[model samples]
Target: MEERSNYVLRDNNDIGTVQIADDVVAMIASLAVRDIEGVEACAGNMAGELMDKVGIKNARKGAKIDIFENRVKVDVFVNIAYGYNIPVTCGKVQDKVKTTIENMTGLTVTDVNVRVVAVSMPNNK
Candidate 1:
């Protein structure tokens, strides 16, 4: 019997393999976005919300990844802070996400689409 995993290490002489999961990639994106200055929180989509209701916490809540055709496409949903610049913040996120994923996982990130789902203002109370 042969073993199976998600990752395929692209080295012929190396005697090792790495299996990376989609959720792991999503988590990486989530962490990368958190390092930015203007992000308030990760905003999960409809399916993510439904999963939360069922007592399941998806680590890739805000980050969605599709790996195919020798590349990966990631979509991140987030709520931004009111005082920060949206375009600048998103650009930083895009760059960070792409770089971090590629550097950490050795995968090619083709597209990183950031969606600002909400704007949250600081409470005055």
Candidate 2:
């Protein structure tokens, strides 16, 4: 696990505190994307891939999370397996990711932008 800075935010009241980090959000997003069918992979970029190789799961891989005044926005790159409807798969990923993040983190998801980076064909192993 890479060292992540604490992302704590004071609640509306002075009663308690809330803490969350960028990596946590990314992990949630990656797992959410994997849960949906027809998604081959998250298509992690060079840095994310390198992190994974070292066993330090970046979680954010193909995901970029931006926090703005407590509202979160995510952009995810995806690789869809051949034979699936591009639009349908993208929609599912978007819905799943948005709902998952909102429900799990209790943060307002401004958007979950799905970028279809590449298409991959199934392997005959």
Residue 30 C-alpha lDDT in model 1: 87
Number of backbone-clashing residue pairs for each candidate, in the order shown: 1, 0
CA lDDT of every candidate: 0.78, 0.79
Name the lDDT of candidate 2.
0.79
Instruction: Give the per-residue lDDT digits (tens) of candidate 2, residues 60-95.
Output: 377767777778888877889888999999999999
RMSD of model 2 against the true structure: 4.4
Query: What stretches of model 1 exceed 4 Å from their correct place?
Result: 1-5, 11-14, 44-60
Provide TM-scores for the models: 0.78, 0.77
